[model samples]
Target: MEHKIQPLLNYISKYIVLSKKDEAVLMSKLIYRKYLKGQYIAQQGDVCKYECFVISGCTKMFFADEEGQEHIVMFSIEDWWTADMGSFITQTPADYNVQCIENTELVLFSYDVIEELYTEIPQLERFFRKIIEKAFVASQKRIVRSFSLSAKDRYLYFRNQYPKIEQRIPQYMIASYLGITKEFLSKIKGQLIIDQ
Candidate 1:
């Protein structure tokens, strides 16, 4: 578990170098968590306490409507961060639920600890600001894709963006993420195969 922290440390160091003492201070706040497949990391209406960095396995952030249909918002795998951003930052109920898609290992940092770390390590604040900026850019791209792309084009783009996800995630979940019916997704896949 200790060795697993190195890669994350390296990632943070790229944005700002941390002294050994600061590193130790930062490390002390992180805790390892394990979740089984199908477990909820944060459920709808729950306040998210921790923001998780995936060490291994995958998670999906989704919302279930009144009809019980799930709409996938995002997926996180190795080296990625996953959390209900609205809930985590604002300390409010989450509209979406984050669930593990596989046996997952994560390093979690609580909101309070993160704020204190930013105070103590000014560079960490800059690091997170840059991270948030990148996240916003990605979100903008997703919005553009949803508005401008056909379902088939969207599927193709999603495949290109996360090639490994097809093997890790369920077809129905992918269909949800693409904002299409499962049957339509199946037809799209069939057409793709025939075209190939």
Candidate 2:
């Protein structure tokens, strides 16, 4: 478990240095879990109690519309942090669901544990603030791209950003994430191959 948590510690250390005591406290608070593919780590309408750091494998955060069409919001891979931010922060029901794309290992921290960490380790607060800022920036970029870019451009950008993801997950999920139909994504992929 300690070995699996090194990636998370390294990630935090990139933003803020942790003293030995802070590190121990943070480690103590984490709960490790393994999830199989197709399992949900969080479900819509449930209060999201924990924020998870991926130790391995992949997951997708998505929401189903009234018509029951799933819209992928984001994908998380190894070393990535994932949670429904509003739900976790406000202790409200999540609007999105997080499900594994492959068998996954994660280290989770409850909302209360996070708050305690913030108080116990000031540097951790700074680290999390930076993490949220980055998430916000990424969200803004995705929004801008959706409005400004064509489907092909969006797919291309996504491919560049997460080069390994396409091989791991089904194409339809990628299409959903890009807000395009699977047929359109297939056409785009075909065009790319033809061009090559």
Candidate 3:
């Protein structure tokens, strides 16, 4: 069980050093979970119960508008964290849904547990703060890019960030993430092939 926690500890260590005692405090609070593909980890209008750190596989965080179309907010894979930040922080209803894109293994800490961990391990709080800061920065950049760049450019940026992800997921999911139609995505890929 402790061995299973090493990857998460190593990830946290990249942000802030964790004493073995601090690690134990954190490890005690963690609950490991596995989700099959197509399962919902968090749903809109419900409080996000846990802060999730991905150990393996992929998940999609998205918003489903009134028309019932899903606009992907982001993707999380190995070594990534996925949660509705506002919901997790405030214990309020989530605006986005987090769903498994592949069979996923995650290390989870509930909202109450996070508060407990913070008091027990100050470095844990600092590590989370850093993660939140990066997530916010990335969100802002994605918003700016959506306004400034064409769909093709956005797809290119995503490809650069997750080169092998395309082969793993459906083209339509990637298209939805880029705010484009699947047919339009096909056309864009065709154009890229010709350009190359």
RMSDs, each prediction? 1.1, 0.9, 0.9
| lDDT (Cα, tens digit) per residue for candidate 2, span 1-196 | 6687899988887888888888888889899999999999899999998899999989999999999999999999998988888899999999999999999999998999989988988778888889999999999999999999999999999999999788899999999999999999999999999999
Query: What are the lDDT scores of the predictions, listed in order?
Result: 0.90, 0.92, 0.91
Clashes of each: 0, 0, 0
Residue pairs of candidate 2 with colliding backbone atoms: none
Which sections of candidate 2 miss by over 4 Å? none
Q: Write the per-residue lDDT of candidate 1 for residues 38-57, one digit (tens) a residue.
A: 99899999999888888889
Best by lDDT: 2
Model 1 stretches astray by more than 4 angstroms:
none
Q: What tens-digit string does per-residue lDDT give for candidate 3 at 1-196? A: 7887677888887889877787777787899988999999999999999999998889999999999999998899889999998998999999999999999999998998988888888777888899999999999999999999999999999999888677788888999999999999999999999999
TM-score each candidate. 0.96, 0.97, 0.97
Ranking of all candidate structures by their lDDT, best first: 2, 3, 1
